[model samples]
Target chain A: MNAFLNQLPIGLSIGAVLLLVALGLTFTFGQMGVVNMAHGEFLMAGAYTAYMLQSWAGRQAVLVALPVAFFVAGLMGLVLERTLIRRFYGRPLDTLLLTWGVSLILQQVARDLFGAPNVQVKAPTWLVGGAEWSGIRMPYARMFILALAVVCVVAIWFYLARTKQGRRMQAVMQNRELAACSGIATSRVDQRTFFIGSGLAGVAGVGLTLIGPVGPALGTYYIVDAFLVVVAGGLGQLRGAVLAAFVLGLLNSYVEYWSDASLAKVVVFAVIIGFLQIRPQGLFVLRSRKLT
Target chain B: MRRLREAADAVASAAVRWRGPVVFVAVALLLLVAAPAALSPFRLELLAKYLCFAIAALGIGLAWGKGGMLTLGQGVFFGLGGYAMAMHLKLAEAGPGQLPDFMVWSGVETLPAVWEPFRQPWFALLMVVVLPGVTAFLLGLLVFGRRVRGAYFAILTQALAAAFVIWLVGQQGLTGGTNGLTNFTSFFGLDLADENDQRVLYSVVAVVLGLLYLAFRQVVASRFGRLLVAVRDGEDRVRFLGYDPALVKTVAFTLSAISAGIAGALFVPVVGIISPALLGVVPSLEFVFAVAVGGRYTLAGAVLGAVLLNYGKTTFSEHYANGWLYLQGTLFIAVMAYAPKGVIGVAGQVRDFVAARRGRAAPAVVPPARVEEGAAA
Candidate 1:
């Protein structure tokens, strides 16, 4: 019973990390319909950003790294969009292959720059401790990640719901032709979407440093899971991503607890494949009138 | 003189008709006779390994290029076939009623039930083709039945590959763990250590690849091939026209999986190992890379691409290990960006350009606009 209670926070924290990594994918893959395989690299870029900042900022580098990493990753995404991805627009599978190439390049670059070993970032002093309540031990780092996820979600909600540019992005996602007809500059919206999407991955990376190992292959480990989250959550639906991420996270946590880690991975994949069998469109379906 | 001219015209038209088969026979002769005679024992074995990859590439060509299913997890099928063959080899090496060496090391008291059936060489060989075929058919039925495709299908397949590798790694007692099944002494009754036996093995692989290539070429030229293209270009339209797109896709996917399995099975003997490392997401993507580089739409191109790209990989890695990933990544991006149809497509363009320059009408070549237009719509 105590073990189960302990697992709740751990599960939520895992879900938080999943949500963070998947948030950017929601924009690029879901909204823009571009399968950016290099989005994981953006997370890597962010983690590396935090690692780099440690020279001057010490343990507190993570807090300052968030906004910086977002921009850095965002800019990298913009360059990828303008240079290579733009040419392959409307072709999701090609983009998948193209971005995979970009991912390979980025991974090699990371390996070359950082060497083949994992570089550890010192957790902020505040994030080192944990709060214990009724046999549930919730580390401050996990709590911080959860808090960050919530804050990012709220900010994103506000941006999409309240801001005009956010609505423009939504309009483009819903119907590109219709949005273009209304002078939305669908290309600009796509750029913005890619930036935010990639930026969110960077933020996710920042949070990940507190919980997981930071290395060149770090992105590859989470890329599939993040993708699965977006896949099960459905495209162009924020609420769906949230629901799916948490569910998958809890499933992952509990399953890993019950069985071994490797088996847990297989089980999660099986569940997703089985789930996808029933709901091909996923947990949420976007209602569109466009015909192909 | 008029009769002689008429006869010459008749011969020219016949040559055009027989071009494909003639070329196939020529390539077969080159692979079977010329390759083994020219290359060293080590190089011949490497060529055999590449041919295994080529067989898998042929399937990718059919499914991805023709049927429009980007199967990113072909390694799963490949691994399935390889492991089946590896199991049988291990069993044979263990001799009658003995557990494989790894099983003993991992404290497995008896041969596991799954390993039991594999002891029979025929069953193992049969499973090399059957397992992947069945797995693909079921997966295709489930995914395609619900109309889940495109990027979703690719991602799902990749995830399956990842899961498969993880499962393989975890089963230490049964699967030989991460080291995988290696150190085979014999195949069938032939000694693996002997050079003559190795050459014989190479001959068998080359022959199999040639036959499979010819078979798949026939498949791609038939009415079903046209239907597959139609389905790829427009699935909804094909469905409205009273053909089940799902069934057609499933068949193509199944065939591809079977070929990948066969490739994997052959890969074990040629390469002497079947590890989780070779059956992961990256390796599966590498299979796709070969297809993309060669020109996915052409059967011959796929084979050529597999051999050439793998050759490039071997040579490049041998000289500069650190730079190979960069080169590979660049090759993918460059091919996708400037040469969407790959090397064959580029060659076609060059031929057309030369014909046009020589003041002759360029041959009627189908534009590779189906994928772009379909996606755009």
Candidate 2:
């Protein structure tokens, strides 16, 4: 019981990061049918932003760095969409190649700017300690990340479900032509969608700093795992993404404990393949006709 | 006199048609065959590895360019073939009943059961082809059959490759861990270290590459290639015409997997190493880059693309390993933005322009815009 309780926090914390990354990918995949290979790079940029900022201002300002990283990465995402991605809207394969090129460029740029070695982002004093609950010790940082994830999920859900702008965003996602005809500025929506999606990735990167080292290839590491979350959950479904993230996170954590990390990945991939064979549309495929 | 004039015209047209590509291939083959003698063994080995990569690029061109399946996880197939061959060689080196050195170093007590079949070169080669094909067959059935087109397919495949890499790295006992399979001693009982043997292996790779190129040309020129291109243009239309788009895609993807597997099989002997790095997301992207830069839609383009990009990589890394990433990134971006049809596409454009300027009566060559419009429509 103690081991299980201790493990849940770590799983949940990792799930938080996965959720953030997948949530943004859901938008890009769902709306435009584009596989942004550079999605992870967006997350890395955000994480690196925080890392750099933390180095300059010390650990106390980590929370402040999160939003700043979000904006920086988000802005870049908007620019990327306007310049390169917009041209490849209906051509998904070309988009995949183009984004892959962008991803390489981003990674190389990161490598050039900040040497090849792993860089650290120090944890704040308040979040550095541990919490003893149910005879199991849980790290405060992990728990905090979990809370942040939950908050972001709820905030995104509320925004998408309730707000006028959010509804317009959904309208575009559901039916781009219909939404545009109804006076929803689709171009603007695309910009905002990329901004939010990339911002979420940035937030995830900030969240990742708690557990792992940040480097040029940090995003590449999470690229597959996050893509898995998006696919398993059903492309574009935010709620589905969170659920899938939790499942994968828990499965991966348990697999790591029972076997090796690499084996766990193989098992997860096998399971995903099996699951996909069974449910071609995924765990919670969107019901809209447009995607079909 | 009229028959003589007609014969001369026919001969001239045939020569004009075959001149450029024929010369290019002849020159390339001559250079590669001569390279091993002129260059050091290290450079010879590097060229051999580049040929292996070319094998993967050919597969990508078929699967992606012709079939429109944006396969982001080809590394999974590549690794499967690579590791299968690697396991066999390792087992062979370990003798009749011993664990491989990597397993011994990692404290594995016995040989893995899955690896038992690879002891025979025949079995290993078969698995090298079959394993990736079967895996791709299953994956294609699941994704393509369900109509999971575009980005969804790309992401799923990419994720699978990533997962495969992680799995290989984790299985220290079965695989060679993160360092990957290395320290091969022989190929089918011939001493690998001998200069003669090394030269033989290089020649074998060159021959295999030539044969594979010919095979790909035949396949792409056949009715199957037309079907693939049709599917790429309009999956729904093809379906409406009573052709199963999924089955066609699966076949192309499977054949691609077989080619990649063969490449990987040869790579184990020539490259002297096969690791997670070689089969990871990055390498998979590199294969795609090669295809894209060489002209993904053309058969010759795939081979040229892989060879050129890999050669560039070898040169760049040898001189500036630290800065090569930047250089590669610049090259890909420039290629994608300025030359979407790739180098072959650009050459074709130039050829058309020159023909137009000369005011020569020439056969109709389809414009890229028409191809793009047809695809989009």
Candidate 3:
């Protein structure tokens, strides 16, 4: 019972990480319909940003790295959008292969810039310890990641719901033609959406450094999981992403606890496949009148 | 009787009208007779390995190129076929009741129940095709029936590959873990260590590839092929026309899986190992990469792409190991961005350009042959 109780926080933290990584994908893949396989590389870029910031700020780099990584990753995404992904707008599968190529190039670039070995970032002094309550231990790093996920989620919510630009973005997601007819610049909206989506991945990468290894190949490990979250959550539905992330995270944590890590992965995938069978459109579906 | 005679005459005329058979015969001769005679044993083995990949690529050409299902996790099927072949070979090498070396090393007390049936070579051979076929059929039905496709299907398939590798790696006792099933001495009584035997194996693989290419060519030229393309271009329209798009897609997916399985089975003997590393997400994606580079739409293009890209990979890695990934990435981007139809499409375009230059009245632009048929349909 105690072990099961302990897994709740662990599950939540894992869900938090998944949410952070998948949040950006919900925008590009879910809303914009561009399978930017290179999104994971943007996350890698974010982690590297944290690694770089450590030199300037020492142990305090993680805090400073968050905003910086966001823009750095966001700008990289914007450049990719303008240069190559722009051409393959309507063709999602082609975009997938194209971005995968971009991802390969970016991974090699990362490998070249940083030696192939993983680089370690010293955790902030505050995040090194853990807090215990009623015999359940919670690491500060996990809590920090969880907090960061919430902040990112709330901030994204604010951006999309409260802000005028966010509303414009939502409008485009709903119906690009109607959005364009309303004098909203759909192209510009696409750029902003891609920027914000890729930026969130950067932020997710920053949060990840506290828990995981930072390396060139780090993105490939999480890319599929992040994609699964978006896929299960239903495209362009924020609530669905959040719900799916936590559900998958809890399922992963519990399954891993019962079985081995590898078996847990297989079980999670099997479950996802089974879940997809029942709900092919995912947990939620966007209502649109446009015929394909 | 008159109508039947006319139909036969038209079929004969059509066969003669197109230069397809001449090209087919030329390629057949080159692969079966000329190339085997010219290349050394080592080079021939490498060619055989590439041919295994070509077999898988042929399936991808039909499914992804022609039918529009981006099957990114072909490695799973490939691995299934490979492991089946490898298991039988290991059992045969062990000689009657003895465990394979890896099983002994891993301290497995007895042959696992699953490995029991593999002792029979025929059962293993049957499984090589059946396992992946059934898996694809069920998966295709489940996913396609629900209308999940495009990037969703691609991502799902990729995740499946990742999971498969993880599963393979974890089962150290059953699967040989990360090292995978290897060190085979014989295949169906043929001594693998003998150079002549290896050459014979290569010939078998080459012949199988040739036969598969011709068979798949016929499939792509059939009525169902047109429906597959129609479903790819517009699934709802096909559904509205009273055809079940899901069923059509499932058939193509199953066929692709079976081919990939056969390729994998052939790959084990040709390459001499079947490991999790070879059938992971990266390798599966590489299979698709070969298809994209050659021209996904054409059988010849897929075969050429698999052979040529693999040849390029072997050569490039030998010269500059670090540059290969960058080159591969650039190639994928360049192909998708500019030459969507691949090398075959580019060749068609060049032919049209030259022909237009010679005849000023002719239009400069002509659609690639297969794509033109698809569009016209």
What candidate 3 keeps of the native contacts, as a fraction, is 0.64
lDDT tens digits, residue span B1-377, model 1: 99999999999999999997898888888999999999999999999999999999999999999988999999999999999999999998998999999898889998899999998989999999999999999999998887888888888899899889999999999898899999988989878889999999999999899889989988998999999999988898899999999999999999999999999999998989999999999999999989999998888888889999999999999999989999999999999898878888898888988999999999998765454322222
TM-score of each: 0.96, 0.92, 0.95
Per-residue lDDT for A61-134 in model 1, tens only?
A: 99999999999999999999999999987778889999999999999999999998999989999899899997
- Leading candidate by TM-score: 1
lDDT of 2 by residue, A233-280 (tens): 876678888898998888878887777677787778778778877776
RMSD of every candidate to native, in Å, equals 2.0, 3.2, 4.2
> On a 0 to 100 scale, what is the lDDT of residue A226 in model 3?
90
lDDT of 3 by residue, A155-188 (tens): 9899999999999999898877889999999999
**Candidate 3 ranges beyond 4 A from true positions:** A290-292, B1-18, B351-377
Mind giving the per-residue lDDT tens digits that candidate 3 earns over B55-111?
Answer: 999999989988888888999999999999999988888989999999999999999
Clashing pairs in 1: none
**Which CAPRI quality tier does the interface of model 2 achieve?**
acceptable
What's the DockQ for every one of the candidates? 0.58, 0.46, 0.50
Tell me the spans in candidate 1 whose CA falls farther than 4 Å from its real position.
Answer: B1-12, B352-365, B369-377
- TM-score-better candidate, 2 vs 3: 3
Model 1: how far is A96 from its true place, Å? 0.7
Error of 2 at A84 (Å): 1.6
